[model samples]
Target: SGSTQCDKLTSEKTELTVTPKELTLTTENITATAGTTTTLTATFNDDTLNTGKVVFKVNGKTVKDENGKVIYAKVVNGQVSVEYTLPESMKAGNYTITAVYTSPNSEKLTAEATLTVAKASNN
Candidate 1:
């Protein structure tokens, strides 16, 4: 009598995990003369859970509300950063800068800060 042999097969599956979180923005208080141009910057952190594009705005203007709105807004190493200059002719006052990030899944996050403009000294 001859012996019989048997074999068994098995399959395995793996799933990726991802979490949604808000982006972060940070900057120093802006201080500039009335007639001098000043650069304002905002940094974005993906929080290790969310990754996507971000939008920036100043005083509710649309000029700073898009990816290409500002020349310095470019993504590098999974981070989004933007640098923009304030016009020399802007009036002396306090202004607020706001940034919003929208994830691939339609999740939105916002951050804001204030900028103060000072009058030039005549001395």
Candidate 2:
């Protein structure tokens, strides 16, 4: 039997491209009065692929419940919302309402809307 020797082989380089995921938020301007509850909906681009939590803010401040607990809305099928009740002491004016979203593997996304608070009618 005879032994054979083979030369070294070289391969060409291959290139691959990757794209990052994106998220978008949408919300509508709403009007409400103190002591009244309003539904704030935050819709995302992907209907079935987004998973995260949304935090609602007003006038650059985080929203809190009566017990002073911060509110966090969980993303469900790329949509999440909260029932926000205007505080009785809230002044009647246009407030900037923002919804901030955060996920484990996604960049933070934000949306803003104007909240028009009408003066509570004295009844």
Candidate 3:
């Protein structure tokens, strides 16, 4: 061979780290009747990551929707639970309830449950 050339190179690389998936609500399907109360509970797979300061919303409404209102909600040991009291005056129908959770890392997540309101019985 008249001429030859060779080259060698080496480099260091850094990898980016990503956080694990946050907690989520795993409960759905709720049934109730007019003039009665229903309690729905949702459990999170990763409880340690979720703590105080979780927000709950129904049909994009903070307090009262076009039809109903949220009675109460609380987070206990990484599980977010809510109790909704359907007013006796409310018309029987189907409603969609949602729970929006804000993680400590400022990530927004949502959980949904279906609420079926049965007609009041004539007694």
In the order shown, the candidates' Cα RMSDs to the true structure are 5.7, 4.4, 9.5
lDDT of 2 by residue, 51-106 (tens): 78999998999988779899999999989989888888988999999999988776
Shift of residue 32 alpha carbon in model 1, Å: 2.1
Stretches of candidate 1 off by over 4 Å are 1-6, 11-22, 47-53, 64-72, 78-83, 103-107
lDDT agreement of model 3 with the native: 0.65
TM-score of every candidate relative to the true structure? 0.58, 0.80, 0.65
Return the lDDT, model 2, position 31: 96
C-alpha local distance difference test of each model: 0.60, 0.88, 0.65
lDDT of each residue in 1-123, candidate 3, tens digit only: 543575565789989999977556666788789777676666677766446444455455553433665433445676866666677876778777776666556666677777788888889
Can you tell me which runs of candidate 3 are displaced by over 4 Å? 1-19, 63-74
What are the per-residue Cα lDDT tens digits for candidate 1 across 66-93? Answer: 3544433443444556545566676788
Model 1 poorest 10 in a row by lDDT: 63-72
The full ranking of all candidates by lDDT, starting with the best, is 2, 3, 1
lDDT for 14 (candidate 3) = 84
lDDT of 1 at 25: 60
